[model samples]
Target chain A: MANEVESTPNSYPMNGGIGCHSYVKNSHIQRALLHAAKDVITEAIVEKVDITNPWFNSSRTLRVADFGCSVGPNTFVVVQNIIEALELLYRSKRHNPEIPEFHVFFNDHVHNDFNTLFRSLPFSHRYFAAGVPGSFHDRLFPKSTLHIIHSSYALHWLSQVPTQLADRNSPAWNKGRIHGLGASSKEVREAFSAQFSKDLQAFLNARALELVGGGLMLLLVSGLPNEFHSSQTNSAIVLDLLGSCLIDMAKMGIISEDNVDSFNLSIYRTCPGELEAFIEKNGHFKIEKMEELINPVRWDPPDFQMLASHLRATFEGALEEHFGNEIMDELFERFTNKIGENSHIIYDQQYIKETEIFVSLKHRVTDYEV
Target chain B: MANEVESTPNSYPMNGGIGCHSYVKNSHIQRALLHAAKDVITEAIVEKVDITNPWFNSSRTLRVADFGCSVGPNTFVVVQNIIEALELLYRSKRHNPEIPEFHVFFNDHVHNDFNTLFRSLPFSHRYFAAGVPGSFHDRLFPKSTLHIIHSSYALHWLSQVPTQLADRNSPAWNKGRIHGLGASSKEVREAFSAQFSKDLQAFLNARALELVGGGLMLLLVSGLPNEFHSSQTNSAIVLDLLGSCLIDMAKMGIISEDNVDSFNLSIYRTCPGELEAFIEKNGHFKIEKMEELINPVRWDPPDFQMLASHLRATFEGALEEHFGNEIMDELFERFTNKIGENSHIIYDQQYIKETEIFVSLKHRVTDYEV
Candidate 1:
């Protein structure tokens, strides 16, 4: 069953429940990203959103969706921020006493723990909440229905791993490595880059059809600086270390060498230039604001256990499917020990630079009818 | 946590996951109710739905909601039926080449197992599906947003148990019983009846606000006949037998007597007259169709174990909360034995008369704005 589910391109769900290894417990990094982007999101909504839009006037409801919204606390916090900003816009800016009803959709993969999400919903939320389960690369909502779309720290997940990465005959075959970044071959990096472009195009196209004209889409993405090599990022270093650990396991006969060779992480961090090129090519949405965000929560002394747990929470589903569940404990333990050994790398300012990009896009007014 | 959740009223979620005692595995009776209502639902949509209504043409999307949708194969079945009927209406009757997109919201209490519902969704379903977790007695959608609302075998679950049944000094104190029907005191029955009326009113009032003018609301309810005594129904007799088993356990010191006295089921079966009266008083909806449905599935020679399992699945959550989990296996064992001992009651044709009510209501076109 796990293999069958994994064969499907978009089935990598985060660890469910609130256990120690669950995403709910280990999502501090994503939460910090949300905190960094909150002000930017609020500012964009207040400045760029058209309060006099006819759709809002007619429907008397504002529909918002958070794509790739995993189990909450962070999703809930971001949604609350959006609602508060909109309410302020209605009351303070427009001076409209009648605020439209807020209907928010929290979306993720079919295997996401929506039971946990629903159970942990804020008791006194101002908006009606609904959980939408589907790949966001496909259309999840009806045409011209959503007024706001927000995705935070989730766009990095490509729809699937690049097929070339696993084909032995292909130049892009990422043998003995599980990721395309860091010390991966140039061909492998290009393959991942191409896949990211395709996935982003699909995501943008789908959102274009779903969003109303003048709708705002706010995205907080883990990204790379345009001038810096992908290998220089903190995440790339982490993935490289993880891949080395897997290779070590294979050498020790804990896992098969062939399994290690075939396994590839379906994640891609886009640079600002790549995002701009795609949005321009799509032509349906105009970039309203694009800027690098500074994360407020800095780890002065890195917590290696927490970092290891975080990675485990995010990648356990995919890893378990690739190498089987028996190797999980040992694999993560080795990765943690390796992290401790290489702890000095974290102090290398040049190699450990992390980039978070915040982009606000508006659906262009179009004559196309639903 | 169990006590606090139960105390909030509306937190009785069906046993989650696909275990043998889960609602998903034991929902055959509810599935039968849906099958019996399918034809009536399709016919109502064909005859009464206004295809050329401004709402459908303007939005180019039909929003339908199923209130009290449990984790299901049944909810999926019913939603498919509704969508198929709408497609037929658009294609065959109206001769319209353009059929609106379908967006369905499946709703239950906050505690419903939405994860299971989402994972088991029909893979090739035509509609965009969402799970709305909240009580139907409250407003779940924006005003005038829904074009169709359907609930099957779910309206019987009241928002909460009647408080009067637990008050020792009150005339309605239901001592040594778990339900209001079948030899329960007259005061207890009246209290249940009043609670049902209040809950039904809330359901109707909320739907009236959410549904668009000229929208359709279809309901398939487990009910009693107008002139028949509640104590005579098969379910009432079954409840009586189950209550006897609980009292026997209490006598043997297996459970506290006070716990049994305070444990009244929140379910209420409304007769056709009661439904009509509530609709008449509410006045926002016009009854288009009202009739009793004949269930097609019949248990030949009565499978006592299957019957016991079904009852256990439905009531285990409540029972476990009132009395701890340690007694579950023994409680069900005794209940099954008691059912086997009183198997003669199943053959009493008059007492075994089960009533399934099918109701179709049309939202009255009003000048009220959203």
Candidate 2:
């Protein structure tokens, strides 16, 4: 394959196809998050989107995009909700002209299973669908083309693991950890935060260039509260346990400790304050709405198997790439066992306190001089 | 899998991925045709396209689409040629302003392997890339969005097989054959032609809706001369032999005869006269250039194995859907053997006289009365 500008250095496509381990089959929690955010999304569009703009009447089409859309059942649901909400807005305005036709773009990294996504598109969807294969942190569409951009649970994925985390001499060197949380040093944690800030800026800047003036962006990201430590989140706890399982395999001579030391997941949990500050600094978009969504799922006693499957579906590709494909079953088995041993910590109210941030932003027309 | 209006009734996606049997490896002939038409395409754009239109200055972007773009190395080549030619035109015109950015859409059936296509995109190409997943015989884009549309060796694929060919009692009932060529009755051939005409009209009408006024369309199709019979071409000879191979299997009791009777390849080869008539009847596009391309490949003894592989790459999916997967190996083996037996006919000058038609058309601004 030719070197492609669209190919991100660390593209982590969720497991593709409809297999038991695929994202489509294992994204129940994400689906729950989408369902939980539906009303907020609808309300945001109704409140902030300027459907009466002359642009809408003249274009005769509404262009919407879902960024970081993996091979989906959830992304489909997200786009449909957006379209329905837009339709509601059009109806409420009582403008006699026919509702504009919908043209939706499903965007993700080049390696994302667009084939499966395309195949799984809802046949009766009123929208014309196109799959955009590129990193959202880069410009993926022509300027002023997109009207609504939606991304859910995807902003956490940084472009790449921060370079300093793997350097042996750097203060941020994360020698024995797979992420910048749960026993990671303050320097390592700050490195992750800095990377997140940079990634978010790139995302916002690129989107600002692509979106039409007054266009709306609905972002759903998993994050911690301002006062909460990164280590308190359920994801950090599970991932820490996963890292321990990798260590156990190393001790058992099943895999190398060096491989474990070099591998760090490229994900970050941003706080609302940090996100707001970054967006303010960027200044291309106005923060229309930002709220933490309520927890949509409660797993009493925790379904360890289901959790394992979900984690596998989301990270199997990345894990396999780093650790080799042979150790997946044993490694996940050990991770599940470790999760069982530490079930109390996972179920504790303090540990399960991660929040999903729902943000609505409007493209700042004044900021775009052209 | 909800009922999608975008889904064509009889979509035939070429064999995807980069495996031995994939279209990527076997599309040398298509590549040759693309190369053969490059000069003509460049000349047509330079001669016929009005780059000075106010729309180009205001939009600052050009949108081009390649329909029926199978998972490709060839499609990439085609898009590159177009971009380069457009750049040449821009430089020659000395417009002073920076050339408008190119946004290219690679369109094929929803079943096409867009993942592979996206991954194979040129890294340094100066264009934004997108994959539109749906049948070309339907509306795939918003009205007046596309500036240039290209389809090569794809318009021959009908939306579906003619219904009468399988009616058993109809005059067009094509038993013991898989196509309306070579010993098939005139009624069968006429049925195939009618289906092609209908499908072509649908393609034209949809494209007419999507293409901006004064948009250019470059089309390359395999065709026979107006005076020639469908059975006189190289493709027809090979297909007729393939049909005989199926009948041979039926006689050997390896596969049921009824399956063969029910199956007809949903493909038609149009002549220049027929294509011109259809375009004129449609009345949306003005024909700019229509000429037969010079043959780029000459197989001295005819590379039967290569021909077999190429045919397999193109038809394996449709064949598997019609005949059970179990018979694929035996079916192709028999096909190869039959090709060997009829090598003389395939190599004969008269039979190998199939011409590739390259068409350049401009969307008629006056005709599209908005």
Candidate 3:
């Protein structure tokens, strides 16, 4: 049995992130995207699998996988989406169940705590006949066996530390190489792009082996605007808030300047065209559909005040593992203070940022057609 | 080369009847539906036709046909929609110089006035195309030659005469049909349904052959509520108004009560499911997508009043052929008087009628697997 959580690297933080889970749990847009993806997947499966013909039909099973699945509660939402998609495919009369035995892989990072995954196992096992776990980034399954690959909010995370940002000598890694506030230094932009390119390639290579000809891959990742100008008021507002908070923490000497400079944010932004080019270069898949939209994630500050105590208590679950209880409390106090200071901002700035969902179909050179 | 329209049918009283061009001249809903239909047609063409491959490449002479095209300036909108659809499709692609050849067939009943269509044709020989005058209820084109089939505001017209109402021999046709309204008899309902079914079948069969496999069909038709009751205050309002006018005419002995009972409107009413089932039973296609909506006709009493003089002038061309201008002017005076008395009521009632647009792809099975 493979470890499911470790295989899906990008979603490692989701199991423990309180706000992230709830955000994804009730996301109707994400649900619709997944539904559409599932439709494409079922179509691909029915086309490639010969089970539709009675001559090829036998008592067999089929495998479906949702990589980078998180635990807590929303694992079942993914399950619900998948089931609904399957039902639609069946209603379309495009699927044949009798064939090879079904197998499903749920993969994540090695560091991910499986306790949450273990708790949600029953709901998943009941729905999917079989579930296996492993890191998909690393070899987890045999080649050319996957019928469908679905991943959301996972590809943005890099496997190793991002090299462009990690290498201090790199132009992109060095700060202040380009003009002032609002605009990113050209070097920093390049660093982010290089890191994204490397990670996306790794993602494509891994899935290329896993998926058979005519398989489908659906990905929803963070995206940047086509003509993003840093000087825009909306752009500076959130960055200024984050910058102010970091400055406050540095003044208190809670974090060093070195550590601050080492951390790289904004590593996940991609445009639809960029992703399309990447896939096209990889050569074997075709873009079926793409949708890009900005979904703002603003929380109610007035309500936040009411839940201050409960939120403080829950903050322990996040930081207590690395630091002692006292340090965790102090960090929460600072975080809460920052939240109170930024309470004047009308909408909650914290959201999925910019997002894009890409649905692709694996193109194969058939012996007869080619 | 095809004639734009043929002469009017003898059965229809052309006396002051409004032509389609009058309805379409500056309609908002019509434009919106046309734009949407254009988008679907372009996308379907892209998916079905392998434009990149030399063998499958189409000509700059694209053969586009608009069936059930009514005569007058209004047919121009459908032509405009097709032209705009093809143009946008061309621009969206990396400029393919081998543009599709354009040949448009604007088909309608033999009774349609070609003079109006000819007057409406734009003076552009390069792209703007000719009109084909004929009944779509019969064969209109060579097999598999059309790339697009577009129709609007025309499907409701039935092929033959409505089953006659008030069959004096049987009381079955004379029983009370409009339950609450002490007026309508069962004969009217039976007559309407029998006429509608016959017309709908003929309409479907005609379009079925006209649409090539893998070609697209965009249809816009006036629809009534699935559960409309004739006795309802709203439904009866129109009938009551017409009834009063007929009664006045009868008192004057201009038209006989026998003619009133024999008269049946050609308009066909359909619900979503009925339309869907009709397409399904026809077995030539499946619904790619369909939507039912109520679009306001945007007829203000004030606008109608302003256009009344021009309408009367236009009526000269149509009415002079039947009832001489003297009788036509007398009829118009009575209608104008009634409109003035119930201007607000007439405006509010007529525009609120529900309509539907069906965007369906008649899938032709390819050698490729599902």
Candidate 4:
């Protein structure tokens, strides 16, 4: 039974130190990121006119889904904040009283730590909390049932590794490096961006079918600002440093070059323009607000072990899936040392940290199909 | 898909209005009932002063489970009340920053409409809401993981109807009537009592393994009081009236008489002495509080249809399973007429309305086994 707990598909959860990425999710960062967009998200929710008739009571339930709502601490904060805002909107007489019944659906991959997520729920909320286990990239809800959708730091994840990146013979195979590490590979970059566009379209189309007309959605994801390149970004630095450490391991025959080629982080950071174009193409969601915000990483002298854990927690699932669990401790130790060396060298430099995009959308009455 | 929803066994759910007994559960009654025992439950919770030693972190999560937590509205109220009390207890101590988190597991039969139960969960509460689908007759949780358990109107339901009632050749076989309906049959009554004792022992043993030392459990269920005979109880009246109606149907060729004999309700209402004997025999739980409650059903003229629906909702699952769905409407309609006629004949007379037993037990370090 204990073995049942330890041995699950590691494609989504972080390994070691509680065996979950939730430990390193940085709830403070998540809280700060969501709290910043509270007003905008609230505004979208308030503007949602009751397009659903009271006769259609099923849809009348204020259905909200949080895509990629991993195990909590931050999931609660984000959900609570949204619900509170929606409640305030209702109390202000700006929303339908008939829609007071809120049903919140927390969605993630089937392999996500739903047990932990379900076990840590704040059960006294104003609405219903149901765990919908499925990928958000595909439709996880009934048609016209969802009223609002919110996601954070989750959409950057593609539905899968780009097909081109996985093709060993293709120029986009991402040889000897995972995403953003070998930043100059145009084929690799294009494959990630193309996959993101495709996935975002599918995501939008699915939500469009599920969300009633005039429903709302807020998406906060890692992005690349138009002014800055990936090579200069702290996220890319982390990846590059990780890649360098892996290269060092490969030299010692600890990691095979083929394993590196087989592994590519299924994340694609995009600019506001790219997302705007996709939304326009989809035509179901009318973007209310879209902006890029910069979060400067300011840990003086750096905590490499913490950084390694954060990295391990965030991406170890994929790495372990590609490279096997036997190498986890050794890989992370090397990663910690590399980050330690890099942080010391770059400590005085004002590096471009994370760029995040906040997109507020309202589902419009449209004849749209995927 | 809609057929999937409706075609599910409606025997348990009250005849399809909500397809659940939750419609008739009357949250107000539940609230009032639980509120009556607030101080006792509060005292039990507050007395739990281990205050979470860092040495023992696993058990620190104050585990509470509600066995047979049917669909919500009442489930939320009960769970929320308990949590609020626990919070107050913690707050009174000037708050141990480690205010042991509450992880509540809601257990019910697997066929119980868990979707509805989970969907209406009060997610904003202090405790976690997890749906553990299993029969509470057996162990439904990990050993020593639960701190408290609350089960309402659930224990009267035996694991199954007594086997003897269904054995045609056996003298104990109930001929043309359900359990307790043929009041003259001593053999049938003893069989049910035996089954109840056996199931209750199994129930205690299972809960004993799950609950930690010093843990508490509260059970509210339909039972026979010391002064009242089982046959004269209101529940008996409902069952007797239904049985009489079924006999009427059998004569009219609406239902088979054989089906009536085969159909035994899985309920066995016990008196305080019976329960005490069982507890004394299996000394895992020390009875802290035990008493029978009388709810005088004073309807100037009884609403027969309301009574029919109430009965329909409560026993529909097992009834439908024993009989068939074809006779459901005709049977209930006939049941309504009989109850109305019976109520008129008996309304002026002293009628035993409802006898419910409330038992609060404290788990003691006992060297006892079932």
Candidate 4 residue A356 C-alpha distance from true site, Å: 1.1
The ten-residue window of minimal lDDT in model 4 chain B covers B1-10
The CAPRI category of model 4 is: incorrect
B40-88: candidate 1 lDDT, tens digit per residue = 9999999998776676656588999998898898999999999999999
What local distance difference test score does each model get? 0.84, 0.85, 0.48, 0.66
- Candidate 2 residue-wise lDDT, B40-88, digit = tens: 9889878777776654545577999999999999998988989888888
Candidate 3 wrongly placed segments (more than 4 Å): A1-370, B1-60, B91-97, B125-128, B170-187, B230-236, B294-297, B301-327, B347-353, B363-370
Off by over 4 Å in 2: A1-9, A52-57, A298-301, A367-370, B1-9, B182-184, B298-301, B367-370
Interface RMSD of each: 5.9, 3.7, 32.3, 16.8
For candidate 4, write residues A1-370 as lDDT tens digits. Answer: 0112113232374332235344525334455666566666666666653434331233334667888877666677778777777767656763545435566777766556555565455534555465664567666554565667899888888777778777888888777677743268888888888888888888888888777666778898778766466777677778877777777778889888777767778787888777788889999878888877544433433676666766777787787777789988888888888877777544535565556788888777743221
Model 4 spans with C-alpha error above 4 angstroms: A1-11, A14-28, A47-60, A94-99, A296-301, A344-349, A366-370, B1-370
C-alpha RMSD of candidate 3: 25.4
- Please say which candidate is ahead in TM-score: 2 or 4: 2
Candidate 1 local accuracy as lDDT? 0.84
Please, what is the TM-score per model?
0.96, 0.96, 0.42, 0.52
In order, what are the TM-scores of chain A for the candidates? Answer: 0.95, 0.96, 0.71, 0.87
How would you order the candidates by lDDT, starting with the best? 2, 1, 4, 3
